[model samples]
Target: MKKDLIYSLPVLLATACSDDAEPQSNNIQCIHPGEDLQAYYDLLTQNPQVVAAMNLCERPASFQTLLWDKVREAEKTGLPPDAPKPQSYYDFGLEMETKSLSGVSFDSNQYQKIEMVENAEYDFYFPAKDGEGRKLIISNQVLERATETFLRNQEEREPIKTIYTTKEEAQEIYAAHLAHSLWIEKNEKVPWSIIDYNSEQLGELFGTRTWFKTWDEKNDEYVISLVLDHSPRETWKVINDIVDLEDLTDQKAGVRGSAGYRYSE
Candidate 1:
């Protein structure tokens, strides 16, 4: 059976903020600068990598470059001759008007681009209220929540394959997983320990817990016991009080696998 897997990673504070600066909390409201919304949408639609990276809600240097280039190109041709230039930074923000999930909503004028230090990597810039510069870097937690909300509304989701039966298939999943891990590390400055944990527990472990039903011919029937006979037998219901040993075993294996190195993470 085909399944859709979405892994959630923990959000970290951006590395660009100075030691003296306090990191923005998820509660802080960021006003979207009301930049070219259509253009920003176009940018994201055209670039799948950016979409995947946004799933992490942390922007890397390459993602920054892409945004800058998109805005630059727009300035060269799309903007009017008399349009005022952005003070010091590009006026790009996502106005996810009328879209929301959980307790999070992207009301108009309430979302801003995640800010980063100029020419710096894995860092964010949050200008003081009395100071002059870009004022907000969308909090990582807020961004992650927003991304989840936005992805749900999107018609076509980026479906990442989780369970593989062959080395070739496993390699593809590994490559994608590795790429995502590297992107998170580079942009969010997340440690490998956390990444590996999420990968194993949320990924392989969850897959194993649900794997039996996925391949079972009588998938809808209640699993009474594991039969060794090759022939199809009568299905029987199991006691509700029975402990899910399979789930426990999968968790143990996932924890064990995470303790050691894997092809990815």
Candidate 2:
């Protein structure tokens, strides 16, 4: 007969935090000043390794130069003339807004193109804030995929496999054994001396208790039994009352539960 197995593993638990950061509003925004912009551009240009990492090439470079020209013009006039700016320019400006608030500053109305690459992933470009010539780009592609793959592999490697067997079988076995055990615990009240003694002997006899053989021909009757351990008189009475012995002899037609029991013809 085909059977399904069900098992459980320990679950991880966490305590809720008493305090958490409040969410920020979306509509309100800030911009950077001109001197801060120049400082940001100077820092990126100074870091050759950072530049190479972002994959900044001719077009991005030329665009960045134009942005610098625009920044210089903004400095001269203290205002920017309306013109078509590269997407990179807006992206970098947003980044600068965030970074500048965090102690980083850049020139306003200038543009700088930076590429960010990490872990063999495609590079992304960010333009400086408000057409500032300094942008922050990060190579996030590789890192994201690597983290996902690691989690997937970890789950695949777990040792325990949860099984869903036939529900009828599980219910029968659980009811039978549970009733028997409860009866013994309630009625006998065996002295600690006898109880302890019996436990050692029984523990050795039954390594672990699992569902017993089923007898129901149509639905597969199941019962639970202690391995090598005889049931006490009271316990046996409860088992006898709950379990149908005749059902144990018949073959079960189907299995149920989450892991789904297998049936062989």
Candidate 3:
């Protein structure tokens, strides 16, 4: 059977927050990693070896001289007096917007660029709010959710032969996908976690458990499980008992996967 994302690592790296920070709790909402990553930055600053090892800073100071020279040449040539102002997605929809040639203290990017959707007409539907399609440095959990969502929606949903067959290849591809998803964030107007696990519970609405299996070659057995919620077979048993003996209005449905919604505490 061609299965999708059942036992696979997500495109997002399943990165644990730095051990320096508190261990992440399962139910609590995760803080956006970049918003207040001062601790992470401090750790990197004290350890030059860690920075070099991670390659967090990709370029040397001199490398920008080439681009800077070109920019300086353009500066001497001066922009036309009637150069167009930066356009927002609000005005252009999905079409590309023009940017101001002259740098300013305030720019169009500061404003919200909302496009119409069925549920919410004024929605920033594009990746990366500025629409510059710039890349972001992201944490592992977000990357994993991004990857899993991507894999969950593909047409063929086949494992990449190179990655599936070799352990090293798998790690390389996983890292690349994490980086790619980060870049995708730069192109959009907002950022949020995939907010999955609810979909796992959605399965029981039809009297079926959503789970997947993988071969355990060393043990010579097949392992069956669900990623977000464990042992759907067991969870379904409880739901079945509830339906047989009790009225649901008096009892909150309890499931292991969903954090708290529609599931008991």
Candidate 4:
């Protein structure tokens, strides 16, 4: 659960709340990892948990601290008897990756392994993708730990019948999930303040109200619903690539035009 940190826009600060009640540091600039940091990216590629903690982190140190906290929690809960608890981020990552890969019942040769370094080999290996659709690169872990927890909680319950969930409930869950992700990744305490969004410019996100169209099994008809236009990370990546390509093409065109011209001809 997120802390109820009240954050209003700069314009509304005066009328919305008393000056004494306002929290300090309303706006803060965050530094993201750069593309040139090959060593840092390599470390992240090896550690999936670290990557999860880094998704929304403002500073690089925040993710390491988050991972350390998790390790401390695991220790307090009691690891297996005779199991050595990890003391650092590198140790914890290695231990978890090893534990996740143990007791595998299927052939692992079919899947691609994530390498620690392109030019060198490592002792441990993490799969690019598990049987499920989870990606080790972006996801916390490829094993779908969330599903595992859900199954464990429901183990003693009666056989499943109807699964019920509302759009409002889902929106709250979605927002909380993203909020938590930002906290874990970026170490941002308040969800709303994690990304300094211009509330006035974007207004409220009506997109939260959009829902997927579901098929009515009993009526045998397609249920029409408000559709959400997804702005996925892959979409932005493709957009950036397209922009780079266009710039390169323009440069080539300029070069060709210049080459065609001769001095005093």
Strongest candidate by lDDT: 4
Name the better of 1 and 4 by TM-score: 4
Residue-wise C-alpha lDDT for candidate 2, range 34-112, written one tens digit per residue: 3434453343334322222222221122333333444444345443222332222222222333211111123333434
Q: TM-score, each model?
A: 0.15, 0.17, 0.17, 0.18
Q: Which regions of candidate 1 fall more than 4 Å away from where they truly are?
A: 1-166, 189-265
Write down the lDDT of every candidate, Cα atoms only: 0.29, 0.29, 0.27, 0.31
What is the alpha-carbon lDDT for the whole of candidate 2?
A: 0.29
* Candidate 4 residue spans exceeding 4 A from truth: 1-198, 204-227, 244-265
**TM-score for predicted model 3 compared with the true structure:** 0.17
RMSD to true structure for each model, in Å = 27.5, 35.4, 25.7, 21.5
Q: Write the per-residue lDDT of candidate 4 for residues 1-265, one digit (tens) a residue.
A: 1112222223332223222222224342122223332233344344323322323222123432332333333234432111111122122222344322222222367545554332233323445665885766635453446325433433445322222234333323223333233322233221233123333321232112222243232354332232221222222233343443234344345345444334323
Candidate 3 lDDT tens digits, 14-118:
122121223233221211123133243343344333323222232122221221222233233432111111122112221213211111112355533333222
Clash list (residue pairs), candidate 4: 53-185, 56-186, 57-185, 57-186
TM-score: model 1 vs. ground truth: 0.15
Candidate 3 vs 4: which has more TM-score: 4
Please identify model 3 stretches exceeding 4 Å from their true place: 1-163, 189-265
**TM-score winner among the candidates?**
4
